[model samples]
Structures are given as C-alpha cells and as structure tokens.
Target chain A: MEKSAGSVGKVVVDNISKSYDVGRLKEPVLDRCCLTLPAGQLTVLIGPSGCGKSTLINILAGYEKPDSGSITIDGAPVGGPSSDRLVVFQETALFPWMTTFENIVYGPTVQRERLRDEIEKDAAGLLETVGLREFRNKYPSQLSGGMQRRAELARAMINQPRLMLLDEPFRGLDAMTRELMQEYFLRLYEDKGQTSLFVTSEIDEAIFLADTLLLMSARPGRVIKSMPITLPRPRVPSMLTSTEYLRYKEEALDILHEEALKAFEGGSQAAADFVEAYEERETVG
Target chain B: MSLGATSTNAASNKSIPGQQVGEDWLYRAQRALTTPMPYLGIAGIAMFILFWYLTTEYFKLPRFVKLPGPVEVWTEFTNPDPIYGTSMYTFDYYKHIAWSSLRVMLAFALATGLGVPLGLYMGWKKKFKDYVFPIIEVLRPIPVLAWVPLAILMMPGREAPIIFLAFLAAFFATTLNAMLGVESIDESYFRASQCLGSTPWNVFKRVVVPGALPDIFTGLQIGVGVAWFSLVAAEMVSGEHGLGFLIWDSYVLSQYPVIVIAMVTLGLVGYVYSLLIRIVGRSLMRWTQKGQA
Candidate 1:
C-alpha cells in the first residue's frame, strides 16, 4: 500500500565483496558481485553449492556488511536489519518457543505498530493464506518441513517488507510440495508485485518464479548471466515443457555447467559426468 | 493434505527420514507402560529393601552386625522419647520437618531470585561478564561446605548461617547454568531477532530469557540438590533444630536407628523437592516438551 512509483522496492548491489578469514587465509566468498533488481520484480539467483548465495542474501537483509561495497534498497542505503527488509532463513528459524500463530504476530506485536484487533485479523488471514489455520497453536518443531516453511513465510509477510530475501526458502520441501509452494508463492506475489530476491540451487525452480534470472559463478561468486525469463504469468505446468522454456533452460544450464566445472577448480570425472548426465535427463520438468 | 501423492525426485530427499513420529498418543503411552523397565524399577526398589532387611536383621551378616536393622529404625521413628535420645512423636517430628523445609525454601527462593537476573544480565552484557565471570569461576570451585566457617563468621545468628550456606550452595549452579544457557543459544536466533527489528532490551527479555529456560531449569534442579546438601552440613556443624542436626545428634549419642530415621526422612523430602522443580519446568516449557524435542 505504501508503494512509491520510482524508488520503492528496488535493490542495488554495487561492487560488493566479502571474505571470511579461515585462520590466516582470507577465503573470498563474494568477488565484487554487482547487480540491480528492478522495483517490484521477483529475481532468482541460482548457483552451485557454497557460492555465497546465502552470504549475498544476508548482506542484502542487512545482517552482514560487505567488505568494500554499498547496498541500497529503494534509494536509501541499507543499514542493519529494518522491518522494510525481512529474510526467510533456510533453516526453520521460527522461534521454537512460539506457536505458528504467535510467530506470525511477533513482528507487529513487538513493534506495537498496529491496533490489537487489526493484528488479530491480519494474523487470522495470514494463517489462512499459508494453509496453517489448524496448525496455529502448534510449535515449529511439531509442524512438518513444508508447514514450517509456510509458517515462516507468513511470519515474514506480515511485516509487509519492501524487499523479501529468501535464502532457499523452499530448499528441503518434497518436490510435489515444492511445486505447490512455488505456485502458491507466485499467486501470492502475482498482483502485489513485491520485490524479492530468491536464492536456489535447483534449475527448474530458478526459471519458474523469476522475472530476472541471475546465474552465479563459483566462489568468489559473481553474477555470470543476467537473462530475463519472459514466460507469461499464471504459469501452467505445461509451460515447463514449451520450446521457449527449454531454450531458456538450455542457456541457463550451459552457464551453470560452466560454473560447475569452474567450481571444481580442476578436471574431475564426476563434474564431466554430472553436466552430461544432467543434459541427457528427460524433460526440464 | 495429500501433498505426498506426487513423489518428487530430490524434493522427497529434502525431508530427512524418521523425522516424523506419527504414533497415537494413547498407543505410545500404553506401549511405554508395557515396557520391562518400569516394572523392573519397582522390583529393583523392593529387592533393595529386602536386601537391607536380610543383611541387617534376618541373616545378621558380619558386615551388618553393628548396624541398626530397618525394623529398629522404623519403630524408633514413631516413638516420642526413644532410647536413641530423639523425640520422634507428633510435635517433635513435625517441628524438624517444618524447620528444614522452611530454611530450604527461603534459601532456594533467594538464590533463584538473585541468580536468574544476574545470569541473564551477565549473559546479555559482555562487559559485565568479563568483569564478573572470573570471580564467579573462582568462588564456584571453592565448594559450599568449604564456606561453612566463613558463613558462620559472616552472619551472627544460627538461622542466618544455615540459610546463608544454603543460598551460596544453590546460587553458583543457578547463576553459572543460566549464563551457559544464554551462551548455548544458536547464533541464528539472535540474528533473526535482530533482523525483525527487536530492540536490545526486547531481545534480552524475549530471546535471551526464554531461550535460556531449559538450561535454567536444569540448573534449578541441581541448585536445589546442593541447597539440601549445604543445609544439612551447616545444621550438622552448628546449633540447629533441623533434620541435619537430628542426624548428627543421634550419631553422637550412638543412636544408629534414629540416625537412619533422620536419613530416610531427609531422602524422602529431598526427592519431593526435586520433583517440584521438575513439575514447574514441565509446565513452563509446554511448547518445548510436546514436540519431538
């Protein structure tokens, strides 16, 4: 509701670099990664394991500072975490002490920004939206993996953040559940046009939800490809098999395969077999 | 509800096997009751009592020649003015129980009151921990019994010394464990709390306190156990009208049966005290307990 036409919901990562000192050696994780996610777009970044995808999300969420670069959200410089930028962590980070409903209401209740009745109504709607109405009183540990992820989504969404940083938000969900969740997520964000940066390792998931698809290279990780997924909205399962989808998938896979080869840092038989086997597998779906 | 129909390749792999425990509650409880362990526990206690009786009285074994039998202790436990020099009838027995229970509760409550907040602050504030932790570490290792002399010298009255000793005994474990409780929290929870725009004070109240609860409960149980230990030791050495003094006085008079009565009474009371702590812990951590964790 607070959307400003020119500036709101835009994320600009400029020459951001980060490294962790392992003993005396500085292990470079992000190598001057630079990208701009346009306002109100869902951008997905896909890369091989340990390519600093999580680190990038953390930096964007203002949980960590880049070594020598700036990150701006909606023209304002990013500082330590604000309500405007919320992250859904990969690990089920729902407070173990709080129930699913309690977790969803935690943000506004803590900030005391809304009236009690408004918060209660919004919480009811959020729980309903995530299909967790019956599981409201259940603790995070009691919920199934998919349920926990949905609860976390509701928790983050209630904050109504300008930018949502999802660090593989659907990582461990069963494939069928993952598919359902993707559609559920797309439908939720479809009309809202909320800006989000989604990180993933799966190729299909990256293409399915992204307005802009950025394939990341191995660590020191950087954006290798910045292609747009021009697939039509309200995407059906059949579009996954379309020629345009396969064409986009093939180009993305080539970039990923090259990145994987580079990730290995040498000629390994497993790496060679991996890309070959991946390409040969029947259908992108 | 039927999200499992379309089996996923890697997606199914995301869920760790054996994470879900979907057994019926009644079935699980019935199954647990049917186990050999609970029956064995009851049988074990009966066998222990039988062994004590046989060795002391029935068999009159060489090792048990001097010790009082269970029968003698039981009889002496009821008599008003026993041969063992203890007045164990209605008023005398209740008086000792009341005194000891009163001292234990007061000391335990005081220790918890001071220890919990102290630990929470120490855990939350780095500067406070750095300044105080070394002193706490040094004092904790010195042992509560070792401080009996200092406690007596520090306080004037008999009641004050015993209470002081009990408080010190419980304080160290409660404080140290509460500190450890905060330290044990996962780093991600703190990050999550901060990202949600929680102020430092709110973080301390919401995240630090509740997050450290399970460990704090563990500390409370240990603290109460130590409080009993120190209370008895303090009463035994100094002038007092408590269970510990009764045990020592009976020992001095060589009233072995009365000593056993006091020991048994103390054991039953101490067991109940720890049980109370456990009951409180369960009620507080309903969110943690009902789940698999």
Candidate 2:
C-alpha cells in the first residue's frame, strides 16, 4: 500500500480509434487516440459533454472494443474484462436487489475463493470507511444518491484491482458530498497505491484528484495536454481554496473553454483540425 | 464530515424524545387492517348474515318459499340425511366434498408444475420466445371451456379433460408473466454479471432467476385462480363425483339444499385455494417487503 511515483505501471494505447454507425454513414467518435497512463498515479481525462471521455474509459475497461488499435494493460494486451482492471461507472451500478454489504462483497466472492473471509472482513471495514456500516444491511434503493455512490466505490475497491477506472463517479452529487467524496477517495488511494483513470468534466475535480491531468479535445477525442500536478497529497478539501489549486484549475478551464467554443462553431471540421494538430505535434515531438 | 456528524447527532437526539411512539403504533395498526381487504370482507359477510337472519326469521315470511335461515342451514349441515339425499335416513355429504377437493388439488398441482418452467424458458431466451410466443398468442384467446371438444377428442379418458382444462387455464397466464419478468430485468445487471467472469449458466442461476422470481410468483397466483375456475367448469360437464357434479345431480333430483351446499363448498374451496396461493407468494417475495426493488 506504500505510494510509488513516476511511470512505473505504464498503460500503452496504440493508435486506438473508435467509430459509431449513428446514421447511414459511420461517424468517428474517437480518432487515432494515443496516450500513456502513468503508473501508481491518478490520471484525469477531461473534455466537453460528447467528447468521448466515457468511450475511452469503456475501452480501457473492455466494455467496448475500438474499431482500430490495441490497448495494453501493464504488459498484456487487453482482450476483455479482468480482475486486474476494474471500472466504477458514472451510474450507481450496485445491484438493486442486494444489500450494501452484499454489493461490496460481490466482486471478491466472484473472483477469489481463498480470500473469501479476508474479503468479507475487508468489505466490513470498507463499509465503515465509507461511513455506511449502519446501512450495510439496507438495499441500494434505501440509500441516498451519495450513499449509493459510496457503496459502489467500496464494491469496486474490494477486489483491489491494479488499475481503477472511474467514469464521472461523482457527477450527480451535491457540492458538499462531492467534496467529501474527493477527500475519501484521496485517503483510500493513498492507503492502497492503485493506479487510476478518472473521467470528468469538472476542472476543479480533475485538479484535485489527479496526479497527472490528460486534457482531451471535444470530439474524435485525442489528448491535447498532459500536465503533472505539483500539489502534494493527501489532498484535503481545503486544497480547493489554495492559490496553487486555483492556478491549475484556471489552466484546465482555459483549455476546455477553447475546445468548447471550437466544437460549437466548427463542429466535426474543428474536431478533425484538432486531431490533425494533435497528431502533428506528436510526430514532431 | 462536519455536515454528516451534525445530521447524525440531530437524528440521535430526535430518537430519544419518544414523542411519536403511541401515534406510530396506532398508525401501524390502522395500516395493517386496511392493507389486506379480506379482513374487512369478513366483517361485511357477518353483517350480511345478520340481515339475512333478521329478514327471514323475525319477519316471518311464507313457509314454502321462505329464505332458508342460517339455523336451518346449520341444522342441515349437522344432520344431512333429510336435506342432502333422496332417502330420508341416509346421506354421505362428506364423500362429495372429499372427491371435489381431490380433483381440484390434483389439477392445480399438475398445471403449476408444468406451466412455470415452460414459462421461464419462453421468457428467458429470445430464440425460444420467437418460436413459442407466437404459438402461445394463437392459443391464448381461446377459452378453457372452448377446449372441451378438443380435450374429448385428443385425450383418452374422462380425467384427461379435467386436467387439460386446468392446464389450458394456467398456461398462457404463467407464460406471459414469466416473459414480462425476463423482459423487465435491468440490462446492466446482465452486463455486470457477464463482466465478472460469470458464464451464461451462472448468470441465469444467480441473477436472472432471482430477478424474475417476483413476477413468476405473481403468475403462479393468477394461474391457481384460473385453474380453480376451469376445474368447476370441467366438473359440470363430465365429472362423476365433485361439487359441480353434486350441484347438477341435486338439481335433477329436486334436492335444493344439496345443490346450495354444493355451491357454497365450491366457493369456499376456491377462496381458500386463492388465499393459500397468496400466502405462498408473499413468503417467497418477503425480500420485496424490505424494499429491495
């Protein structure tokens, strides 16, 4: 659980491209997107609403296959869902019929038999950590939105995956709950040292949770920038009020704003130009 | 953390006052009484019987066509020889009741055992549904009574019509409900199961079966009621010893008391069967009471 630094557990995306047949013609959603996720760190992917941040997460989680290119996790070629890579979707994916305790223990019970007792113990402790031990016997419908999301997080972490994929995990929470959840995540991440890929539209969340931020263009999503956070952890709620956090937040917002305007005005043409520029820059560098 | 602590403290303080305990008890009692209609229905039946007794006995109507009092019925129930049979000294009313109950039980059990699994399969798999659903739809509109001629032609014996009628009554209802249950399952649930290294068989066993249980139980309840109705019709046509047969036989013999008793027994048996099915359903779906869905 000791925290490690740098690009130790590298994720290689080899010219990944994805397209959907939305109309009669196939429309490209993500075009030749290539990026490396650094090891033992939280990397945030930020973009506008329809910029395919979720698609990238789904591809990484093996929920959807890209039309072209390959993604390698650790060193193996990603084929399908595995215990090593776990996804906490934007939606609360907790089984409605299951109690909170059952949801948390599900992954562990499904994956490893020898670790059953240990997993149950760990699941109980996680419920306490998420402040849901009292509600453990309650079903998902009994919990509030925040509590459901917390249970989902605990469920995802129970399996102890090498790479955690969070797709807008705190999107619908109130402002206060969202801040508390971010702090809880930082604490858990510090304790576990799991590499994570987090997708979000919020600039402040990206700055707060990520060790390295990967800014993406609007559509046919390609990484526009990759900036490492100089801010130290454990990142507390007070860090949001810090001047350094504000500076990083401003930088992410500026990039997002320009992309949003271009997306609004030029549409697919702007996206094509952005991808061309991104590819050109990659070639030159 | 501060916000959560404040809310928890507020909730704990509210619990200590015990202000709502008496009111809560009263509310719960009222809710329990009103939630199930059968409790209220018993009171209604008592009132109706009281009115019947007063109108017939106290008002003193003509003896020939006078409303038969509950006392008379009670007397007839205890000593059935004069009222229930052609002979003045002998009547075997219990024999008819036993035979009727046996036929209903046999037919209902046969229908449920056959209908449920077939319904589950039709609902679960698309390929099975595509082939089977059309056939079910085609057969569904035809009433169980309408199948009497077909049953007579197709089946070898008299018992076959009775069983066939019960099966026809239940089959469509169970199948349709099972299909709805399967269709209504959350797609994400299946996806999640598949993603977690679950094979198709494991997914069906763990997720699909449990998810569809509530709907399936609902179908079973409806099926039982339908089966009882169909059993009555079947007995009316060709039964040798059943409540329906007793009613028809008593009518032919002009024994009005026996006919009324047979009708009452038929009603009571159907009501009891329905109540039993509901109890079974409620117990099986006890988790739903905890608000799982």
Candidate 3:
C-alpha cells in the first residue's frame, strides 16, 4: 500500500460539540472539544464512565455527527462512514454468519472487485499474524471471545484505512486474555502504524497502548488534558509498575478523578453560587 | 494488501480426535429417550378412536349415536365404489386431492412472490413503509372471509376469486413475518457492513435478505397454513371439486362417512404442506444451525 512511514495518520478536531435529546431536555455531551492526534501514533481517549466517550469515537468514525466544529483525517475532511474511516464496535460486530476468513476479507471484497486474489492472500496472512489461521473457516459463534476480537482486528486492518476507531475493543475479556490481545494488537500496529483513536475507561491500558493520551471531562465531554507518553517503542505490561508509567498514570488519574467528582456532585455548589449572586445583584440594583 | 501463501488462512476443519467422539450407546440412548413423540402420538390417536367407538358403537350415547362411528368411516374409506359416495370410486379421491393440492400450491406461490418483496421493502425503506403501512394495517385486520365478496366480484372467474381468497389468507403472515425478520437483525451487523464499504443495494443483498430469512421461512410456514384455511373456505362457497367442496357435497347427499374422509384428508395435507416448508427452511439456513438440536 506504500503508506508513508511517519506523520500521515494525523487527525485534527476543531471545537467539536454534540448533545442528545434525552427525552425531556437536550443533554449536552461534548462541549467544544478540540484535539490534534499526531500522525502515525496511537492516540487514546480516556474518561469517567459517563463521559460520552463512545459518542466522541462515533463522531470520529463518521458514524455520528457533532453539533458543531469539524474533524479532518490525514488532511481530508471526515463525513459519514467511508472505507477511509472504520469503527470497531464495543461489542463484537463480526457477522456471525460469516467464517473468520470470509469476515476478514469482507471489507476488501465488498469495496472493490479487482485484486480479489491479492486481498484473499492478504487476509490469509493477516489471520496467521493474528494467530487465527487455524480458525479461519469457523463461524464467529464458534470462536472464543479473544479469538473473535483478534478476527475483528484482522477484519478492520485488512482495509488499510488511514484512521481506525476502536471503542473499548477489549473491555470484556479476562485480564490475562486482555493483555495478550493488547500485545497482539500492538504487534500488528507496530508493523502498520496507522493512525488510531482507541477509547478506554482504563488508565493503565491507555498508558500501555497510547503515544498520546487525551483525558476527557465528564458530561458535556471535552478534552481536559493531553499527556504525551515518551515510553520507547514496542511497549510491555511490565511498564505499568515502572516510575515513568506511574508518573503519567498519576497525572491522568488526578484529572479524571476531579472530573468524576464534579459530575458526581452535579456541580451543585457552583450552581448555588450563581443563583445567590443573581439574587444579590437584583437586590442591589 | 498483497499477502502471500506463506501466511495462509487455511480454514482448519479440525476436531479434537478423542474429545469430539462420545460413546455410541450414549447417542442410541438419547435417541431412544427423545424419539417417543411418534409413539405418544400413535397412542393418543388410538385412545381417541377407542373413545369414539365406545361412545358411538357400544354405548350409543346421546349425540354420539347420531354421529358416524370409526368403523363405518373406515369401511366406507376402504370400500370400492361404495354407497356413501361424493364421487363413486377410489380414483375420485385422488382427483379431489390433486385439485386441492394444485390450488393451494398456486395460491401459496403467488402470495410468497408478492408478499416477501413488499414486506422487505417496507422494512428497508422508511418512506415506502410510511406510504404503505396505513393500507396494510387497515386491510390486515379484516378477516379473510371479509375479502370473499370483493374477491369474487373483482377477480375474473370462480377460480381467480378462490385463489385470491387463498392468497389473501397467506399474504399477511408472509409479509408481516418478513418485515419482522428484517427488524430482528442486530443493528451492529448493519454498522459493520457500512464500515466494510457496502453500497445500500449490496447491504440489502448480503445482509438484509439473509438476515431476514429465518423470519421469512416462519412466515411461509404460517402462510401455508392460512392458505389451507382460506382454500377450504373458498371451496365451500364456490369450488367445483376440492376436499372442502367434497365435504360440503357429501353432507348434502347425507354421506357422513365421506364428509369425515374429506375432513381428514384436508387435515393431513395441510400438515404435510407446513412440514415441507419447514424442511426447506432448515436446509436453506444451515448456517444458522450452530449444530444445535
């Protein structure tokens, strides 16, 4: 595919905002969020549980639209879902009707007709790389959970898209299996190094996979902090206890904890202060 | 994306050698335990026949005395050109069966051809659904009998109206089931297809049709049953020769045994038609089996 080795998977978000009409009132979810995901590196979005992280990823994947602002992927403006941008859903979305081999080649087969044999060969190799060559013909129903996630990764990766959006792709696996998947994914990423936006609520996972981590605020979500991880390439779980990992984790946890508290408290003190100030100003006038 | 043979995605059809195979007696025992339905069914029928005989032939109780006994119907069915005659011969029985089967098949095929597309399109395209839904909702609830007069007036001939009635009976179930089938598909499949670069038409072909198949087959099975119900209704009203017509004509002639025979024939054929639909449904959807019983 001759993808440029560096600085090409860049994503720029310009003051994107979004809200949902949660029945009675429109609830603001993302408030004027701006982010620049540097090209050819892994960018992780992490936040409190209710921070509308999926909403942000959905917008970036072009499956959703923000209320305001814009997203550009590698200098091209993003719009509704295109092959250039793909999303890995939180729940496994591999078609159960399809075999591992069929699913991996689905994107390529459906997108274009020429070069089918070439794509088939690529799919076979991808299955091998992901350690699923033995399970290629099996239906998704037959594959173990971890194997299904790996097959999903192979399916997405085969497209060679400029930007990949993963929303909690490994959230449900056991801790051991999750770690293995992260490494398996990491190995694949190192080879391709495509620009990716990986969303997770877990701090350690973010630090392990991220080149740059964007810490998002709770409700009315937006980027509150950006931490650059300077860990050397080909990361490992052992880095979790290391001093450098601890420092980054501490800073992120601090910001995330503050946001979580603000959300939990409903920011009532600030609201109370505003009401009191309004009454005083009216009385003085 | 040019990957080579060295990294093969060769579909492994491997089963754990010893783990996959259970002992033969285990399967034999399972079969023995589970296949009791046929025997149970035969026992139930025999008991019902016994009750019928005891009440009608031996005891000669109330209304049972007036009703034809199992022996009388059995003898009449076995008779060659016997007295209780709709048509006088055994070949005439075959004729009635052929005619009714032909009618049911024609009406069922027509209903499936028309209804499945309408249902799928209604589910797929929202605007089309909005336009068509009011009429379907209003018309679907009206019983098939209610359509008989309009069908008789609107269709060209007796056969056409009769077929129309049969089609009407089957159409709603077929259409509604197919639509529900499409709706039942997980939204994730649609999203995945979009991410994989499927055109809307391609999505319909690959995802929508296959995903909705289980429901469509269900609709067909129900549709065939409904067709049988309407076919008889139409036949009683206007049919020249069918099982339903035979039942009515035998009643007029006071041939009670012939009427019973005609009723039984209808019941048996209706069952086999539905069974045929189920067999086809299972064969077509082998992918959905997951090898489960």
Name the candidate that leads on lDDT: 3
lDDT of 3 by residue, A216-261 (tens): 8878888999899999888977888898987887677667767776
Error of 3 at B170 (Å): 0.4
Per-candidate iRMS values, in order, are 8.3, 6.8, 4.3
Candidate 1 lDDT over residue span B1-293, tens digit each: 01111122123335545443334434544554355358788899889888899999999999897899878877777776677556466576678888999999999999899998899788878899999999998888887788888888999987999999999989998998899899888888887777777888767876888789998999999999999989999899995699999888878888788778888888989988987787667655657766533
Please report, as a value between 0 and 1, the fraction of native contacts recovered by candidate 3: 0.63
Task: Candidate 1: list runs displaced more than 4 Å.
Answer: A1-7, A266-278, A281-285, B1-37, B80-88, B291-293
- Candidate scoring better on lDDT of 1 and 3: 3
Model 3: pairs clashing at backbone N, Cα or C within 3 Å: A29-A221
Instruction: Give the fraction of reference interface contacts each candidate recovers.
Output: 0.54, 0.26, 0.63
TM-score of chain A of 1: 0.91
Q: Which candidate would rank higher by DockQ, 1 or 2?
A: 1
Task: Give DockQ for candidates 1 onward, in order.
Answer: 0.29, 0.21, 0.39
lDDT of 2 by residue, B1-293 (tens): 12222233344347555666566547645654456667678899899878767777666666634445666665666573565552222445667667767766777676667666677677678899899888888989988889888888998888878777877887777778877887788877776665655566656665666678788778877887788778778878878877777778877876666666667666777777777676666544434665532
Native-referenced DockQ of model 1:
0.29
Q: What overall lDDT goes with each candidate model?
A: 0.81, 0.74, 0.82
